[model samples]
Target chain A: MSFREKIHWVTLVTMILAFGWYFLVYPWRIVASPAGVMATAGMLVPVTIAIIVAMTVATAFLAIRSPREVHAREDERDRNIHMRGTHFGYYPLVVGIWINIFLIFWGIGQAEQLNLMIATLVVAEIVRIGTQLYLYRRGY
Target chain B: MAKPPFTNDIRTLRFLAGEMTQGDLGDRVGVTRQTIAAIEQGKYSPSLEVAFRIARVFGKPLEAVFQWDDAGD
Candidate 1:
Protein backbone atom coordinates (compact mmCIF):
# COMPACT_ATOMS: atom_id res chain seq x y z
CA MET A 1 0.00 0.00 0.00
CA SER A 2 1.06 3.56 -0.55
CA PHE A 3 1.98 5.75 2.42
CA ARG A 4 -1.13 7.84 1.95
CA GLU A 5 -3.37 4.80 1.83
CA LYS A 6 -1.89 3.48 5.06
CA ILE A 7 -2.49 6.83 6.71
CA HIS A 8 -6.07 6.84 5.57
CA TRP A 9 -6.56 3.39 7.08
CA VAL A 10 -5.14 4.60 10.35
CA THR A 11 -7.40 7.62 10.33
CA LEU A 12 -10.46 5.56 9.54
CA VAL A 13 -9.80 3.07 12.31
CA THR A 14 -8.90 5.80 14.81
CA MET A 15 -12.01 7.85 14.18
CA ILE A 16 -14.23 4.82 14.38
CA LEU A 17 -12.68 3.60 17.62
CA ALA A 18 -12.54 7.00 19.32
CA PHE A 19 -16.05 8.02 18.31
CA GLY A 20 -17.36 4.59 19.03
CA TRP A 21 -16.16 4.88 22.59
CA TYR A 22 -17.60 8.35 22.94
CA PHE A 23 -21.10 7.43 21.79
CA LEU A 24 -21.27 4.17 23.66
CA VAL A 25 -20.14 5.65 27.00
CA TYR A 26 -21.93 8.95 26.57
CA PRO A 27 -24.59 9.86 29.13
CA TRP A 28 -27.45 9.67 26.71
CA ARG A 29 -30.04 9.93 29.56
CA ILE A 30 -28.95 13.50 30.17
CA VAL A 31 -28.92 14.39 26.46
CA ALA A 32 -31.78 16.81 26.93
CA SER A 33 -30.07 18.76 29.71
CA PRO A 34 -27.32 21.38 29.90
CA ALA A 35 -24.98 18.91 31.58
CA GLY A 36 -25.21 16.75 28.45
CA VAL A 37 -23.70 19.53 26.42
CA MET A 38 -20.96 19.86 28.99
CA ALA A 39 -20.42 16.14 28.85
CA THR A 40 -20.09 16.26 25.07
CA ALA A 41 -17.59 19.06 25.33
CA GLY A 42 -15.69 17.29 28.08
CA MET A 43 -15.51 13.98 26.24
CA LEU A 44 -14.50 15.54 22.95
CA VAL A 45 -11.23 16.81 24.45
CA PRO A 46 -9.81 13.34 25.03
CA VAL A 47 -11.20 12.01 21.78
CA THR A 48 -9.63 14.81 19.78
CA ILE A 49 -6.36 14.40 21.61
CA ALA A 50 -6.38 10.66 21.07
CA ILE A 51 -7.02 11.01 17.37
CA ILE A 52 -4.28 13.58 16.94
CA VAL A 53 -1.78 11.53 18.88
CA ALA A 54 -2.65 8.34 17.06
CA MET A 55 -2.40 9.92 13.65
CA THR A 56 0.87 11.62 14.52
CA VAL A 57 2.40 8.39 15.79
CA ALA A 58 1.17 6.34 12.86
CA THR A 59 2.44 8.86 10.32
CA ALA A 60 5.80 9.03 12.02
CA PHE A 61 6.14 5.27 12.14
CA LEU A 62 5.08 4.84 8.54
CA ALA A 63 7.45 7.57 7.39
CA ILE A 64 10.29 5.91 9.28
CA ARG A 65 9.54 2.57 7.71
CA SER A 66 9.38 3.95 4.16
CA PRO A 67 11.67 6.94 4.08
CA ARG A 68 11.61 7.18 0.29
CA GLU A 69 7.84 7.09 -0.15
CA VAL A 70 7.45 9.62 2.64
CA HIS A 71 8.79 12.33 0.35
CA ALA A 72 6.71 11.26 -2.64
CA ARG A 73 4.39 13.96 -3.85
CA GLU A 74 0.72 13.45 -4.58
CA ASP A 75 0.26 12.41 -8.18
CA GLU A 76 -2.62 12.68 -10.62
CA ARG A 77 -4.31 9.48 -9.44
CA ASP A 78 -4.20 10.60 -5.83
CA ARG A 79 -5.76 13.94 -6.67
CA ASN A 80 -8.47 12.31 -8.72
CA ILE A 81 -9.32 9.91 -5.87
CA HIS A 82 -9.40 12.82 -3.42
CA MET A 83 -11.79 14.81 -5.57
CA ARG A 84 -14.11 11.83 -5.93
CA GLY A 85 -14.04 11.23 -2.19
CA THR A 86 -14.91 14.86 -1.51
CA HIS A 87 -17.74 14.64 -4.00
CA PHE A 88 -19.21 11.69 -2.08
CA GLY A 89 -18.60 13.32 1.30
CA TYR A 90 -20.46 16.50 0.34
CA TYR A 91 -23.79 14.71 0.20
CA PRO A 92 -23.77 13.70 3.86
CA LEU A 93 -22.59 17.13 4.97
CA VAL A 94 -25.41 18.88 3.17
CA VAL A 95 -27.96 16.41 4.41
CA GLY A 96 -26.69 16.77 7.97
CA ILE A 97 -26.83 20.53 7.86
CA TRP A 98 -30.36 20.48 6.56
CA ILE A 99 -31.41 18.07 9.26
CA ASN A 100 -29.79 20.18 11.94
CA ILE A 101 -31.64 23.24 10.64
CA PHE A 102 -34.95 21.46 10.72
CA LEU A 103 -34.30 20.18 14.23
CA ILE A 104 -33.54 23.70 15.38
CA PHE A 105 -36.84 24.96 13.99
CA TRP A 106 -38.63 22.05 15.60
CA GLY A 107 -37.33 22.94 19.10
CA ILE A 108 -34.81 20.16 19.64
CA GLY A 109 -32.73 20.43 22.83
CA GLN A 110 -29.30 22.01 22.57
CA ALA A 111 -27.39 18.89 23.55
CA GLU A 112 -29.46 16.78 21.18
CA GLN A 113 -28.76 19.14 18.36
CA LEU A 114 -25.09 19.17 19.25
CA ASN A 115 -24.92 15.39 19.27
CA LEU A 116 -26.75 15.25 15.99
CA MET A 117 -24.28 17.65 14.44
CA ILE A 118 -21.41 15.61 15.75
CA ALA A 119 -22.88 12.43 14.34
CA THR A 120 -23.40 14.13 11.01
CA LEU A 121 -19.79 15.23 10.83
CA VAL A 122 -18.52 11.85 11.89
CA VAL A 123 -20.61 10.08 9.26
CA ALA A 124 -19.49 12.49 6.60
CA GLU A 125 -15.85 11.94 7.49
CA ILE A 126 -16.29 8.19 7.45
CA VAL A 127 -17.91 8.35 4.04
CA ARG A 128 -15.17 10.57 2.70
CA ILE A 129 -12.33 8.42 3.97
CA GLY A 130 -14.12 5.24 3.02
CA THR A 131 -14.61 6.45 -0.52
CA GLN A 132 -10.95 7.35 -0.85
CA LEU A 133 -9.88 4.02 0.53
CA TYR A 134 -12.16 2.24 -1.90
CA LEU A 135 -10.73 4.15 -4.81
CA TYR A 136 -7.21 3.43 -3.66
CA ARG A 137 -7.90 -0.28 -3.39
CA ARG A 138 -9.51 -0.28 -6.79
CA GLY A 139 -6.45 1.44 -8.27
CA TYR A 140 -8.28 4.57 -9.32
CA MET B 1 -14.88 -1.45 -11.75
CA ALA B 2 -15.23 -1.59 -15.50
CA LYS B 3 -12.05 -1.69 -17.56
CA PRO B 4 -10.91 1.43 -19.37
CA PRO B 5 -12.08 1.79 -22.95
CA PHE B 6 -8.47 1.52 -24.14
CA THR B 7 -5.59 -0.87 -23.53
CA ASN B 8 -1.82 -0.54 -23.26
CA ASP B 9 1.35 -2.62 -23.61
CA ILE B 10 3.29 -1.06 -20.75
CA ARG B 11 4.26 -4.42 -19.30
CA THR B 12 5.67 -5.66 -22.58
CA LEU B 13 7.47 -2.40 -23.25
CA ARG B 14 8.90 -2.38 -19.74
CA PHE B 15 10.23 -5.89 -20.29
CA LEU B 16 11.82 -4.93 -23.59
CA ALA B 17 13.39 -1.87 -21.95
CA GLY B 18 15.74 -3.94 -19.73
CA GLU B 19 12.87 -5.02 -17.47
CA MET B 20 12.17 -1.59 -16.08
CA THR B 21 10.38 -1.59 -12.72
CA GLN B 22 7.04 0.13 -12.42
CA GLY B 23 8.53 2.43 -9.78
CA ASP B 24 11.27 3.46 -12.17
CA LEU B 25 8.79 4.08 -14.93
CA GLY B 26 6.52 6.01 -12.56
CA ASP B 27 9.44 8.21 -11.47
CA ARG B 28 10.32 8.90 -15.08
CA VAL B 29 6.70 9.64 -15.93
CA GLY B 30 5.94 11.64 -12.76
CA VAL B 31 3.29 9.30 -11.46
CA THR B 32 3.02 6.62 -8.78
CA ARG B 33 4.00 2.97 -9.24
CA GLN B 34 0.41 2.00 -8.58
CA THR B 35 -0.77 4.36 -11.27
CA ILE B 36 1.50 2.67 -13.76
CA ALA B 37 0.24 -0.72 -12.62
CA ALA B 38 -3.32 0.45 -12.99
CA ILE B 39 -2.65 1.76 -16.46
CA GLU B 40 -0.97 -1.48 -17.48
CA GLN B 41 -3.89 -3.51 -16.18
CA GLY B 42 -6.38 -1.24 -17.91
CA LYS B 43 -8.00 -0.35 -14.60
CA TYR B 44 -7.35 3.36 -14.98
CA SER B 45 -7.22 5.83 -17.83
CA PRO B 46 -4.36 8.25 -17.55
CA SER B 47 -4.61 11.90 -18.46
CA LEU B 48 -3.40 12.99 -21.90
CA GLU B 49 -0.21 14.49 -20.54
CA VAL B 50 0.52 11.41 -18.48
CA ALA B 51 -0.12 9.17 -21.47
CA PHE B 52 2.32 11.20 -23.54
CA ARG B 53 4.88 11.16 -20.77
CA ILE B 54 4.70 7.36 -20.50
CA ALA B 55 5.22 7.04 -24.22
CA ARG B 56 8.14 9.40 -24.06
CA VAL B 57 9.76 7.39 -21.25
CA PHE B 58 9.75 4.31 -23.50
CA GLY B 59 10.98 6.30 -26.53
CA LYS B 60 7.92 5.23 -28.43
CA PRO B 61 5.12 7.13 -30.10
CA LEU B 62 1.88 7.47 -28.12
CA GLU B 63 0.03 4.94 -30.23
CA ALA B 64 2.73 2.36 -29.65
CA VAL B 65 2.19 2.45 -25.90
CA PHE B 66 -1.59 2.69 -25.89
CA GLN B 67 -4.17 1.68 -28.47
CA TRP B 68 -7.91 2.13 -28.77
CA ASP B 69 -9.88 -0.99 -27.74
CA ASP B 70 -12.16 -1.16 -30.71
CA ALA B 71 -13.35 -4.53 -29.43
CA GLY B 72 -14.85 -2.80 -26.36
CA ASP B 73 -16.88 -0.50 -28.54
Candidate 2:
Protein backbone atom coordinates (compact mmCIF):
# COMPACT_ATOMS: atom_id res chain seq x y z
CA MET A 1 0.00 0.00 0.00
CA SER A 2 1.02 3.57 -0.56
CA PHE A 3 1.97 5.70 2.42
CA ARG A 4 -1.18 7.76 2.09
CA GLU A 5 -3.35 4.66 1.91
CA LYS A 6 -1.74 3.29 5.06
CA ILE A 7 -2.34 6.58 6.82
CA HIS A 8 -5.99 6.53 5.79
CA TRP A 9 -6.35 3.01 7.18
CA VAL A 10 -4.87 4.08 10.48
CA THR A 11 -7.22 7.09 10.62
CA LEU A 12 -10.28 4.94 9.83
CA VAL A 13 -9.43 2.42 12.53
CA THR A 14 -8.59 5.08 15.08
CA MET A 15 -11.81 7.01 14.52
CA ILE A 16 -13.82 3.82 14.70
CA LEU A 17 -12.23 2.69 17.96
CA ALA A 18 -12.28 6.12 19.64
CA PHE A 19 -15.84 7.01 18.66
CA GLY A 20 -16.98 3.48 19.32
CA TRP A 21 -15.81 3.87 22.89
CA TYR A 22 -17.39 7.30 23.18
CA PHE A 23 -20.88 6.20 22.10
CA LEU A 24 -20.74 2.87 23.87
CA VAL A 25 -19.87 4.33 27.28
CA TYR A 26 -21.84 7.56 26.95
CA PRO A 27 -24.47 8.20 29.60
CA TRP A 28 -27.44 7.94 27.26
CA ARG A 29 -29.96 7.91 30.12
CA ILE A 30 -29.13 11.51 30.93
CA VAL A 31 -29.23 12.59 27.28
CA ALA A 32 -32.27 14.80 27.94
CA SER A 33 -30.74 16.49 30.99
CA PRO A 34 -28.32 19.44 31.32
CA ALA A 35 -25.72 17.18 32.84
CA GLY A 36 -25.79 15.23 29.61
CA VAL A 37 -24.46 18.24 27.75
CA MET A 38 -21.71 18.58 30.32
CA ALA A 39 -20.93 14.91 29.92
CA THR A 40 -20.66 15.31 26.18
CA ALA A 41 -18.32 18.24 26.62
CA GLY A 42 -16.28 16.43 29.23
CA MET A 43 -15.93 13.29 27.13
CA LEU A 44 -15.05 15.19 23.99
CA VAL A 45 -11.81 16.42 25.53
CA PRO A 46 -10.33 12.95 25.83
CA VAL A 47 -11.65 11.80 22.48
CA THR A 48 -10.16 14.77 20.66
CA ILE A 49 -6.88 14.36 22.50
CA ALA A 50 -6.77 10.67 21.74
CA ILE A 51 -7.38 11.21 18.04
CA ILE A 52 -4.72 13.89 17.83
CA VAL A 53 -2.16 11.87 19.76
CA ALA A 54 -2.87 8.70 17.86
CA MET A 55 -2.65 10.41 14.50
CA THR A 56 0.54 12.17 15.47
CA VAL A 57 2.20 9.01 16.66
CA ALA A 58 1.03 6.94 13.74
CA THR A 59 2.12 9.55 11.19
CA ALA A 60 5.51 9.85 12.87
CA PHE A 61 6.01 6.10 12.86
CA LEU A 62 4.92 5.73 9.28
CA ALA A 63 7.09 8.60 8.17
CA ILE A 64 10.05 7.07 9.94
CA ARG A 65 9.45 3.70 8.35
CA SER A 66 9.20 5.12 4.85
CA PRO A 67 11.34 8.19 4.72
CA ARG A 68 11.09 8.43 0.95
CA GLU A 69 7.32 8.21 0.71
CA VAL A 70 6.98 10.76 3.49
CA HIS A 71 8.14 13.48 1.13
CA ALA A 72 6.02 12.39 -1.78
CA ARG A 73 3.66 15.12 -2.99
CA GLU A 74 -0.02 14.56 -3.64
CA ASP A 75 -0.52 13.62 -7.25
CA GLU A 76 -3.51 14.12 -9.54
CA ARG A 77 -5.00 10.78 -8.64
CA ASP A 78 -4.83 11.58 -4.94
CA ARG A 79 -6.44 14.95 -5.49
CA ASN A 80 -9.18 13.41 -7.58
CA ILE A 81 -9.90 10.82 -4.91
CA HIS A 82 -10.01 13.50 -2.22
CA MET A 83 -12.43 15.67 -4.18
CA ARG A 84 -14.74 12.74 -4.81
CA GLY A 85 -14.64 11.73 -1.14
CA THR A 86 -15.49 15.24 -0.05
CA HIS A 87 -18.36 15.28 -2.51
CA PHE A 88 -19.77 12.15 -0.92
CA GLY A 89 -19.23 13.45 2.61
CA TYR A 90 -21.15 16.64 1.84
CA TYR A 91 -24.42 14.75 1.53
CA PRO A 92 -24.37 13.51 5.13
CA LEU A 93 -23.33 16.91 6.41
CA VAL A 94 -26.21 18.63 4.67
CA VAL A 95 -28.68 16.00 5.79
CA GLY A 96 -27.43 16.23 9.36
CA ILE A 97 -27.72 20.00 9.43
CA TRP A 98 -31.26 19.85 8.11
CA ILE A 99 -32.21 17.29 10.74
CA ASN A 100 -30.64 19.37 13.47
CA ILE A 101 -32.61 22.39 12.29
CA PHE A 102 -35.86 20.45 12.39
CA LEU A 103 -35.05 19.12 15.86
CA ILE A 104 -34.42 22.64 17.09
CA PHE A 105 -37.90 23.70 15.92
CA TRP A 106 -39.33 20.68 17.74
CA GLY A 107 -37.61 21.85 20.94
CA ILE A 108 -35.30 18.87 21.35
CA GLY A 109 -33.13 18.94 24.46
CA GLN A 110 -29.76 20.68 24.17
CA ALA A 111 -27.83 17.52 24.91
CA GLU A 112 -29.76 15.60 22.33
CA GLN A 113 -29.04 18.23 19.74
CA LEU A 114 -25.39 18.14 20.68
CA ASN A 115 -25.21 14.39 20.44
CA LEU A 116 -27.00 14.42 17.11
CA MET A 117 -24.53 16.93 15.80
CA ILE A 118 -21.65 14.82 16.98
CA ALA A 119 -23.07 11.75 15.34
CA THR A 120 -23.56 13.66 12.14
CA LEU A 121 -19.95 14.79 12.11
CA VAL A 122 -18.69 11.28 12.81
CA VAL A 123 -20.79 9.82 10.04
CA ALA A 124 -19.68 12.45 7.57
CA GLU A 125 -16.04 11.85 8.43
CA ILE A 126 -16.43 8.12 8.07
CA VAL A 127 -18.09 8.50 4.70
CA ARG A 128 -15.40 10.84 3.51
CA ILE A 129 -12.53 8.63 4.59
CA GLY A 130 -14.28 5.48 3.48
CA THR A 131 -14.92 6.88 0.01
CA GLN A 132 -11.31 7.88 -0.39
CA LEU A 133 -10.12 4.48 0.78
CA TYR A 134 -12.47 2.78 -1.64
CA LEU A 135 -11.25 4.87 -4.55
CA TYR A 136 -7.67 4.18 -3.65
CA ARG A 137 -8.29 0.46 -3.48
CA ARG A 138 -10.13 0.63 -6.79
CA GLY A 139 -7.10 2.26 -8.40
CA TYR A 140 -8.80 5.56 -9.23
CA MET B 1 -16.21 -0.33 -11.70
CA ALA B 2 -16.11 -0.38 -15.48
CA LYS B 3 -12.76 -0.31 -17.21
CA PRO B 4 -11.54 2.89 -18.84
CA PRO B 5 -12.47 3.30 -22.48
CA PHE B 6 -8.87 3.37 -23.58
CA THR B 7 -5.73 1.32 -23.05
CA ASN B 8 -2.02 2.00 -22.86
CA ASP B 9 1.20 0.25 -23.79
CA ILE B 10 3.13 1.44 -20.72
CA ARG B 11 4.17 -2.06 -19.72
CA THR B 12 5.59 -2.86 -23.10
CA LEU B 13 7.25 0.51 -23.37
CA ARG B 14 8.75 0.15 -19.91
CA PHE B 15 10.11 -3.26 -20.84
CA LEU B 16 11.59 -1.93 -24.03
CA ALA B 17 13.21 0.91 -22.10
CA GLY B 18 15.42 -1.43 -20.08
CA GLU B 19 12.59 -2.58 -17.80
CA MET B 20 11.97 0.79 -16.18
CA THR B 21 10.29 0.60 -12.82
CA GLN B 22 6.91 2.25 -12.35
CA GLY B 23 8.37 4.33 -9.55
CA ASP B 24 11.07 5.64 -11.83
CA LEU B 25 8.57 6.55 -14.53
CA GLY B 26 6.27 8.16 -11.97
CA ASP B 27 9.11 10.26 -10.64
CA ARG B 28 10.04 11.41 -14.11
CA VAL B 29 6.39 12.01 -15.01
CA GLY B 30 5.57 13.78 -11.71
CA VAL B 31 3.05 11.27 -10.42
CA THR B 32 2.81 8.37 -8.00
CA ARG B 33 3.81 4.86 -9.03
CA GLN B 34 0.27 3.69 -8.33
CA THR B 35 -1.10 6.20 -10.83
CA ILE B 36 1.17 4.77 -13.50
CA ALA B 37 0.08 1.27 -12.61
CA ALA B 38 -3.56 2.30 -12.74
CA ILE B 39 -3.05 3.82 -16.17
CA GLU B 40 -1.31 0.70 -17.37
CA GLN B 41 -4.15 -1.47 -16.11
CA GLY B 42 -6.77 0.91 -17.54
CA LYS B 43 -8.32 1.35 -14.10
CA TYR B 44 -7.79 5.12 -14.29
CA SER B 45 -7.70 7.73 -17.00
CA PRO B 46 -5.05 10.35 -16.56
CA SER B 47 -5.36 14.01 -17.35
CA LEU B 48 -4.17 15.22 -20.73
CA GLU B 49 -1.07 16.77 -19.17
CA VAL B 50 -0.14 13.59 -17.39
CA ALA B 51 -0.79 11.52 -20.47
CA PHE B 52 1.54 13.73 -22.45
CA ARG B 53 4.10 13.56 -19.69
CA ILE B 54 4.04 9.78 -19.74
CA ALA B 55 4.45 9.81 -23.49
CA ARG B 56 7.37 12.19 -23.21
CA VAL B 57 9.03 9.99 -20.61
CA PHE B 58 8.98 7.11 -23.06
CA GLY B 59 10.17 9.30 -25.95
CA LYS B 60 7.02 8.49 -27.93
CA PRO B 61 4.01 10.29 -29.29
CA LEU B 62 0.88 10.27 -27.11
CA GLU B 63 -0.98 7.95 -29.49
CA ALA B 64 1.97 5.56 -29.37
CA VAL B 65 1.41 5.08 -25.63
CA PHE B 66 -2.38 5.15 -25.52
CA GLN B 67 -5.05 3.95 -27.92
CA TRP B 68 -8.82 4.03 -27.82
CA ASP B 69 -10.68 0.73 -27.60
CA ASP B 70 -13.40 0.92 -30.27
CA ALA B 71 -14.88 -2.38 -29.13
CA GLY B 72 -15.83 -0.76 -25.85
CA ASP B 73 -17.86 1.81 -27.74
- Over A1-140, each residue of candidate 1 has an lDDT whose tens digit, in order, gives 99999999999999999999999999999999999999999999999999999999999999999999998999999999999999999999999999999999999899999889999999999999999999988766
Q: Residues B1-73, candidate 1: write the lDDT tens digits.
A: 7788788999999999999999999999999898898889887889999999999998999999999989986
Per-residue CA lDDT of model 2 for A22-137, tens digit only, reads 99999999999999999999999999999999999999999999999999999999999999999999999999999999999999999999999999999999999999999988
Fold similarity of candidate 1's chain A to the true chain A, as a TM-score = 0.98
Report residue A11 deviation for candidate 2 (angstroms).
0.9
Per-model DockQ: 0.72, 0.78
State the iRMSD of every prediction, in order shown: 1.1, 0.9
TM-score of the second chain in each model?
0.96, 0.96
Q: Give me the candidate number with maximum DockQ.
A: 2
lDDT of each: 0.93, 0.94
